[model samples]
Target chain A: MTLLESRSRTSRSSHGGTAEDSRPGDLCLVVMETPNAPHSEAQAAVSDPPADLSHRLSVLLESIGRGDQAAFAEFYQLTSRRVFGMARRVLIDPELSEDTTQEVFLQVWQNASKFDPKAGSPLSWLMTISHRRAVDRVRSSQSSTDREAKYGASTQDIDHDSVADQVGSRLEAEAVVRCLETLTETQQESVRLAYYGGLTYREVAERLNAAVPTIKSRIRDGLIRLKTCLGVS
Target chain B: MTETNSGRNGRSGSFGDTVAVDLASGRAVDLAELYALDALTDEERQAIEQYMSAAPAAERTEFFDRVRQARETLARTFRIEEQPPADLFDRIVAQLPVQGSGPDAGTPAPPASGHIAGGQFAPRQPASGQPAGAQPAGGDELAQARQRREERRRPGGTRRWLAGVAAAAAIALGGVGVGSYVADQNDPMNQVVRAGDLREASVDVAGGGTATLLISSSEDAAVVKMNGVPAPPAGKVYQMWLIPKDGSAPVSQGLMDEEALSKPAVVEGISSAAALGITVEPAGGSQSPTLPTVAAAPLGA
Candidate 1:
């Protein structure tokens, strides 16, 4: 189904139609078929950008801000999978993740005019929104359930969640893991429990048998350390 | 003031001193980063958010960037490969408020109801170091500028704006500076502060100081003044709430900064509130007041 859409889209665009007329559905169909297409190919058919993928995304976002539907479609085609994948990992429920992704993109469509290139890279901006929305869904739903129900009795389980193994070996992901490895063991645990486990500092402290203040400081310090390691200015 | 002296303070030697001052000031400079990563408790988040709403743009920006970077780093660690339902993209596009289309082509341009389209506040680097409030250009430029500012006002836009404003406000926040930045003349806040026929209500703070609610004669807006209230302790911030006369949920008015203790903060959208309530909360303002009201005043009285 996607292939037919892509072929029709390619032919349509090639035959005097503006590239902007092609839907993202068509773009992704083509993108998914490209292997070794560089870890960061935001636009296919365009020459591969050398380490300037962030720059391309920023430009595309700027165009989207101007009410360019084509730019938005291109963005959606390139990024929806990664966005959905992030939602899935955090929400841990496929159905909920789908809903969150839908909402996230809806927000993107409604709020694309709000993207500021100077703030950060386009991917980070979108991911930040994706993370926040997914977490909100998790927290609101978790409010009705027992908080202590998810993590078992021992703190040892904090380190053993299979979620960590599921991380892809993309260069950026590898770099993150490398930077994460630089933290002290306790800092690593605190960050993981808070970020991946989606537990608040108080809960992380409870799981680690430490004070809440201590957990807060650990997470803060750990993040600062991670920032420096990641070379984020 | 010499390079040698500056270097020493820049080193880890002065790190302890800096931490002590931040703590003594009751500022959660550290927790601001944690709050961004969703690592803090509700109370902590509220406190930090309150601090941030009034914090210097440089500080807020630094923290926001750190948080964004932290999130981006953590995001890379997610190894899943799930795709959203196929129709999701189409659904999003279908719902978009179509732009530039005729009456039948797309959704009519959202009523230019002056409602901020929001999510636009990606802080631009202000070349003149002017307050962000003053430079909102009129007409098309104004619309673009308003959209930018409104972005920060949107959910999820706060963190994003905090980062943008950091860059935009880097010099501007300093020009407006402590105790006066929020008072930038262009903000609606100024109208309430200078409102004619104002009324007043006061409540004593249990921690220390007094909080006064200054309502405009028309009761459309309010300016809150805090006196002698010490900086909030770690993991906590002072949040203001508006309780409707009809017993509806309290509407959050935003975090009250430490500076507001020494000055006045105009609470937007509170003229109709039956009473005004202040509570200690975790950094970002709460969904509802989490702690008992530390201070309360009847607005109608």
Candidate 2:
């Protein structure tokens, strides 16, 4: 649809002041390869994006708030893969993941009006909601019981190699994998189990045979190192 | 326990109440990392939320910024993206209410006269006498239900408003309230069912079941009592809507989740609504009434 092309120019000019100040290069590679790789025109906009893409998403959300179905379709096309991917990572069941994906998009449609750019970038807002919904589903009583039964039949150690295999061969994924290597063994395990495994810090501590505070500090320190290495801020 | 240093334990106490207090009091900024990772329980998250709410606005903003950055960075690590099923978008579209056109376009304007018709309330028997079953069999049932609504809304077959003392007398003679629970004075179900000007109507739900609406124009509310209504399809719920007489978008009344099925659900703000409609939606409901309502009853005035 022409929605993306028409809105991108308006949003670019409107967000010029903030766009000029932010670190445009920090997330450029990551954003480029993640969700928008399938669309050729989207790839062209990757050169100076961090704010450009975020502003475009914000504008799409605003359009969706006014019940513009075309804009909603465009937004879904742009972000559904990543949303579904996040749900797959946490829920692991194909059926559940598909259901969660539907729920997340429906939520985006219903709550588009509540989005505030001042709170966070549009991708960040979307990922946060996706992660929360997936995690919530994982923690629900029935699913957790099923997971526990499944886990009891498997090894307790975090499957680091499996995670590595799941990372695509793209530059961003490789970069994150490299940053993850920089953390100590304990930090890597703690962070991986808690984030991708959808386990609480207490559960991470239980799994690792470490004290709760030790697990907490490991996650905090590990994230700080990754944040710096990835140039997130 | 003996392997740890005494100093860390001494500072935070024995890992239960003291640590929770530390988190609630805003002393545990490091917990922001766990919060970002979605690694905290609901109680832990609530404590952090309490701390953030009390902190200065700038400090609060900074905390969220930190969480956002970490979360975004972690999100990038999810490199393998899977395109959702091809039919998923169509299914999502199915859940959105038809807006600004289509079936909603040809409805006549609401009557301008102020007062409602004083005719007797004629309780129509449900078309099918079968009990509400499990989930709806399939889309065929929904299509049939929509056809029934279309027939009812046809120009010449417009539903007439029926109300009178005789109808109120009939309701009074029907001994028990809709639910088995004792009707407390403050109960919403009691308030509407016991109102002086209450009107009642029942519509057979699509798959198999009945939904009865008890309306009180004086209270500007209605209570929906669902009987033998099939559970919504997996991962979905029945959402109620108030269809305005002016043909604008329908306003959502609320959702009837599985647990809510047996009980009477009170729907307020019915004064401007010309009809009540029920649609099966994704859990948590949709912003508008999804087309092809499972059932509908005119709130004629």
Candidate 3:
């Protein structure tokens, strides 16, 4: 489905399409395929970026930590819309989302130096912060039900093809979805519990009644399968 | 970290240690690297960090590759589009106080001085200088000029020429020494009589809450009127230290309390400190600080 349709659905659920309809921007879709979309695997045949996107983010963060305002602006220009979207997804109010955006940026300014590339990807770092901040806001404002409803609805359309279609066009998330499909039913379920459900590996293991090591290995194997199947560099 | 040469594998009965020989489909797969990249629980992450940190030297290469590949895929999987808010950098810099201020504030270059609080800075004898007297006039003179310029800038160039004059004087008298270095060395008004060595110190509280330390040396042991830190709490005072950063234990200079000296209290051993620190300690200062948050006034910062 297009981003427009998703926003329309979100609009139906809460703010009634007001914010969605008002924006004159391109409804800018990165437009990769959804995991369930037709012809999902075909997008993987075309290779695009040679390096992982995290490295680029790491460099941007390093310059930002050095107090480079121009770099900070550029980082924001590229990242703000997505962050705003995620914030809006979790926090229904535009004003609150904007406030979260401001706080997220302030955090970025304060903690940029802590972004060590060795630990993990910039996306994870940013997402973790965004999610935590969003969660904090939800809890603080006593708006858990409203926030979760919007979150649950928007994420309902999680297709294997969409990641490919949205973030990058070249080699879609087809391989990841396909590799994920190849896992044993239990392993696949475990991977899902950990990934989409945001459960830790230990929690995944506990829920599956499997040993922690098994859960760990299963998730890792699942990802490796996705990496190889997707032909991701 | 203190675990055995090899981890005492506790998974004997654990699922990981089970011997399930897949005879029918005899293919073994290793997934340690893959699991780490997936953001496992803290325990799992700790296990991996231990395994990787202590992995046999030979296995490191393969391990790193798997880790890197996993990180790449995951990095690509999620992306963040967040940016810093406006003018944050300016605010961060603004929060940082200026390097020099307070009583011991005029010396050029940073020298060994008893550590004082409230970011009071001591001037070091310029690499080339006539000691005890270097035209103290230039020191505060330049400071006042700087303030005037700053004041002028405050109104957004309201007093443009005055600010300009101050700026010009600052440029002329900075460490670059546009004027004669020796010209003011002999002037008594410019020289602080080396009181030899400070005997003791006391925190002298002032009207505006700024606490000054009166440090008296022996006869003529450079009496340094270290000032500027506002008086700390009564129950908890700012304890002084002649902190040596050479990795050695600290030496106590003195504590700043209300009952201390009202004027510049003399302190012995005031000139050998590599760095000075003020920590909030018990009423009667402790051997070590209870809270030593160095409000660092960097030497020459």
Poorest lDDT segment (10 consecutive residues) of candidate 2 chain B: B160-169
lDDT of each: 0.53, 0.59, 0.41
**TM-score of each predicted structure versus truth:** 0.48, 0.50, 0.37
Best-to-worst DockQ order: 2, 1, 3
Provide the RMSD of all predictions against the true structure, rounded to 1 decimal. 23.5, 20.6, 24.2
**lDDT by residue (tens digit), candidate 2, B1-301:** 1323222324443233234755654445556678899998888898789878887887788678778778767765554344454345545655665433335211211122111212322222112321111012222342233224433653321221111100111111111233343445556655675565665554556665556577888988887767557789899999999999888999987787787776667788888898899999999899987878887876753
Worst 10 contiguous positions by lDDT, candidate 1 chain B = B165-174
**What tens-digit string does per-residue lDDT give for candidate 1 at B1-301?**
1112111213221112232343345444554556667654555566666777887898787667666676655544443443344335545655667553333223211111112233333222234432232322212343234435544344433322222211111111112212244434466554453344444444455565556455674648776666446787776788888898788999887785554444456665665677788898887668999766776765653
| Higher-TM-score candidate of 1 and 3 | 1
Q: Highest DockQ: give the candidate number.
A: 2
Q: What's model 2's lDDT at A157?
A: 26
Residue A185 in candidate 1, Cα distance off native in Å: 2.8
Worst 10 residues of 1 chain A by lDDT: A16-25
By TM-score, the candidates rank as 2, 1, 3
What digit string (tens of lDDT, one per residue) describes model 3 on residues B207-297?
A: 2222222233233221223333445666876565655546577677566564342223323354444434556777778897554332211
